[model samples]
Every structure is written in C-alpha cells, then in structure tokens.
Target: MAKDGRGAPVGRRVMLGVLGLGVLGAATGSYVQNSYDNLLAQISSRDPTGVTGLLPGGGGFRFYSVSESIPHRSDQDYKLTVDGLVDRPGSYSLADLHAMPSTRLVRDVQCVTGWRVPHYAWTGVKLSDLLDKAGVQPGAKALRFTCFDGVYTESLTLDQARRPDMLAAYRMDDKPVTAAHGGPVRLYAAPMYFYKSAKWLSGITVTDHVEPGYWEHYGYDVDAWVGKSNGRDDDPTS
Candidate 1:
C-alpha cells in the first residue's frame, strides 16, 4: 500500500484565524468578507490536510496544492497549452475553451485521503475531444498535465485520456470554477481518485509514455482508480 507524505500537522493559530474570519464574514458580509475568502485560499495553499479547503471552497471538495500558493488566472491571462506529440501545437484562452463544445457530468468525487463528495456537477470539454482537435500524433501513447502552480503534474495513458468521462473541466458547482477549486480550468478524471484530476490545469502535453505525477512519485499509484489503488476497499466511484 502507498502512503502519502501529506496530512502533516497544521497550526492551531491557522485554524483559529480561519474561524475568526468566518465569524467576521458572517457578521460583516461586506468586502471584508470577500477578502476573508481570499485569505482562506492563501492559507489553504500551504494546507496539505484539506481542512481549510472544505471551509471556503464551494463544494464539499477539499483543496490541496504542492505549490506555496494557489494561482489565480483570468480569462485574458489564462491559457491551456497543447503540444508535445500533437500535430497542432497551440494555446487556448479561457474564452476559446468556453466557446467549444461542453459536456456535463454528475458523479461522486472521491479523494484518496478519505473524503467523498457525492453527485458533484462537472462541465467541460472532453479530453479526447481536445486531443482530436489538436490531432494527436501516431507516436503519442500518454498525456502529461502541467498546472499553473508550477509544481503539480499528472499523467495518463492515451487510452485512459480518451475515456468519455475524462474532461478538461471549466465549470463546477453550476458556476465558474473558483481558484481554490482549480479555477478557470482543471482536469476531471471521473473514474479515478480525485488526485488524478489535476487542478489549476495549464498545459496538456502529449507524450510517448506516462510519467509519474508528484503524488505518484511519493509512492501513490500512477493509475489511481478509486477503490482499486492505495489498498482501499471503499465503494467504487466510477
């Protein structure tokens, strides 16, 4: 069984600060409250436990990042790069992605760290669809995802990337994805553990083989299907 190095002890001061901000947000409900949400995001960027993630984030989903901070990208500045083994190499802005065809899915989001958020709504362009548009090369056998945070990366086999359930999701919770939730765009691998779905998605580079993601390098399974990998016997999310 693979055990992750995360879940380290966070500070009590951080929790107390969050709680205080939550009270302030409730009491004020002004710009300060909005700022509180942003402050929580800053705190959660360094939080491996996802405890702060459940507080300000929209869904029950918890936030975790390998980077020192969560990145925020706007429509004008955010771009998803498609390159590597593809015939067409280019970047797509948030507007370009929003104009493309979108598929909606409602599925249980199960995390490897013993958390479950059921029947969450996800909407985005299918990964296979994006690959087709980019014209994957004959030599391509895998996909490597790089995030805007500059630390996290994930990979999938070509067959797995082509699954109908795999998506480059731009929307969740029936609204635009917030930065804490992986923001303007993120990967949604419905059949796998939530960690397999990389957040703050920035680049999708087609490759000839799969490279282990950050967690995978730390003894997590590269193909982290729910209830299958990590030696857990929980209900299958797929």
Candidate 2:
C-alpha cells in the first residue's frame, strides 16, 4: 500500500490500480485526481440508480441516513445562524455569505467506504473567517453543525474546525449548489470523508467538548479521518 500525503496507508487495491496505470505511462498524481473529479461530476449529474449510483464512481463513498430530510427552501428565505459559545450570535442570509471574502479550492474528496474523487472544486468562505467574526470564546472546544434536514448533524473539534481547508461551501462545479448536492450551503471538511461535510447545513453551535454526530453514535468514527479512523484503510485526502 502506498501512503497518502498525510502518511496514512492507502488500500492495497487502490495502490495496485494506480501503479498498474503508471506502467501504462499515465501521470499518477494530477491525472488520477482529475479523472476522479470528472467521475464525480458525471455521477452527480444523473438521477441516482441506488446507493451506488448516488455516489461518485459507482460505490466508494460512505452513505449515511438523514434520519429525515428537511424541506427545501429558496435562497431568498434561507438563513444560517451562528450561536452557542460566542460573543456575537447572529444570523446570516444567503446574501451575507456571498458578501464575505470567498475562496476556491480543488482537492480530493475521500470517503471511508473506499471511493475517492480527487481535485473536486469547491467555492466558499473559510470557516475560520466566520468563527473569527463570531468571536469564539476560549471555552469553545467543539463545533456542532446542524443541517436543515434536521436528521443530519456533525461536530468537529476546535482545531479541526479552524483548519484552513474547512469551508462553508456555497458552490460546486463553478456554479451555485443544487439541492440534490447539499444545496445553498454545506460544510466542506476537506481532510475527512464526504459525510463529515454535512449537507444542507443551517446552524453552528460552538461548545466545550466533542459531541458525537448522528452517524458517529451509530458506529461511525467521530474523528473520521479518511484512512485512519474508519477501519477501511483508505488514503487520506489531504
């Protein structure tokens, strides 16, 4: 198995495939990344055939239950609230997010299930910027992210939440996010599996200890690093 940039061991199957293709004169790193991203686009553009089809490249990404999906709302009526352990607890509209300094990144999207989509482009605000604006208190040790779907929720340790790659994403594929793809806003945790990037994100509550998210309580690892925690032995996206 080859180690990813973060030194996590990649699955032997993935490493073998990649190495075999290298013998065919294919450039390994960037080329594989671009191919994976293209595959994700193709998968997302079509109706899902099943769990396998809903994810990129057949069935490598992890899938979690929503418990329930919330009703979709238009951008005009959408609101995101930042509350909990902060000096400034306030609400932000879609316009508010658009008005902030925006960032764009193209990085690998890995899942615990074994699939990966590399070089996927995401555009949004740095999560740290929002935390800074909200004035996170010294006591804040975790961030709970609640989705509009009501059933989906996630939490990150303070250090993880502040990572430069984390984003409150508004756009994907160079366009505004569609409802099927997590919509008007979503949490993008670049170093973790796609599940950590909760869809239809709505609320952010800063707290003092780690809170196991919906999936975490149901056998998923709370600190879900791509290869390190899930028992799947995949490569780290970072």
Candidate 3:
C-alpha cells in the first residue's frame, strides 16, 4: 500500500493488464492528501482507458486527472476568459468570479466508466450568467470549454450551455476545489456525463458548430448525456 502525505494507507495502485492499467484500489479518508499524487503518476504513465477514474477520493467521489502531471495556478494568477462571437468579450479574475452571485445545486455525477456519485453538491456561477454578460452573438450554436490543464476540452450546444443546471463551478461538496481535483474553477454540466464537466476550466468560447472534446476526439460521444450518449444505459443522473 502507498501511504498519503499524512501517513495514511492509500490502498494499492491497480496496475492491471492493458485494458485496465493504472486503476486504483478503493481507499477512503479525508486526510490522505498524497493519494492523488500517486494516482497522478500512474495516469501519466499509462493509457487513459478509464483507469484513473478508479482512484479513490477521501470525500466519496473518485479523482481523475488526465494530464502528464497535475498543473497548478495560484488564485492570484488564475483568470477565466470568455470570448469568440461575443459582443462584450472579457476576462475575469478569481476574485471577479467570487463576487458573482452563486448558485448551488445537488446533482448526481455519472462517469462513463460505470461509477456514479449521487447528490454531489456543486457551488458556482451559472454559465448562462457569463454568456449573457458577454452578449452571445447571432449564429453561435455551441460553447467550447478549454482547460488550464492544456489537454482537456469539451463542447455543448448553445441550449445546453445555457441551462440552469450548467455552471462554472468553483467549489465541490461545500469546499474550495483542490488542485488535484481541478481547482481554481471547473465546469459542471449537471445533465451530461462527468467528462462534459471539463476540469481546470479557463476559457469559454462561443462556436458556430459542435467541436469534439478530448475524449470525443478519441471516439467518446460528443454530446455526452448521462446515460444515453456513450452506449451505456445507466440511469440518467440529472
């Protein structure tokens, strides 16, 4: 077993056969900070075949970061840019986001890999609020999300992006999101599969058409509805 920063056992790393390499053994604790560090190493060293999704979260939900290593941005340096086909394009600092009215929602998180965390509470500004502030231009059909992580991207149709359930999330389960868990801020598309909620979210661009996201480019569905998009019939989380 690999121990965490506080010397708690983080269970074991599951270096299974090719189809399941880099998965993690179930470990639970609120104090095991280094578990994410070990799991992040495993992710960078293997394929993205849903292996990282198995890494345990001390707070009940699992953690997954697809980058070669987790990236960090201090709150002082972090900014979210909203642009493309918009009239009032603008950049917002972390403090700017915090000043916005907050919306909190309790929704289920369904990962494409067959894991579901029901009733996860997320707190953030509504995506529609930002889009409205930017004054979306005519002919904008979709919204694309780019991450500070450098590799992850996700898109949603204009209608989907404006839904009340969609948010630019800054907190999860009532706590400020940590770096290992896509901190500073992330997107939360409550009705879509978890992947649609891009982590380390940095940009929101209005697009003329639906662009495939990172996983979608790798054959996952671009419109990742909870149970309908990816060939799985699990119950819808929204």
Q: Which candidate is the best by lDDT?
A: 1
TM-scores across all candidates?
A: 0.75, 0.74, 0.75
Better of 1 and 2 by TM-score: 1
As for model 2, its CA RMSD to the true structure in angstroms is 12.5
Off by over 4 Å in 2: 1-70
Q: Candidate 2, which ten residues in sequence have the lowest lDDT sum?
A: 55-64
Ranking of candidates on TM-score, top first: 1, 3, 2
Please list all clashing residue pairs in model 1, or write none if there are none: none
Every candidate's lDDT: 0.87, 0.82, 0.83
Per-residue CA lDDT of model 2 for 86-167, tens digit only, reads 9999999989999999989898888665567667889999889999999999888999999898788899998998998899
The digit string of per-residue lDDT tens for model 1 on 1-238 reads: 7577556556777898899998987788756645665677568768878777556342356668889998989868999999999889999999989899999999999888766777889999999989999999898999999999999999999999999999999999789988999988999999999999999999999999899998999999998888988987668776
Better of 2 and 3 by TM-score: 3
Task: Check candidate 2 and list the clashing pairs.
Answer: 60-115, 70-149
Lowest summed lDDT over 10 consecutive residues: which window, candidate 3? 22-31
lDDT of 2 at 148: 90
The stretch of ten residues in a row with the least summed lDDT in candidate 1 is: 53-62
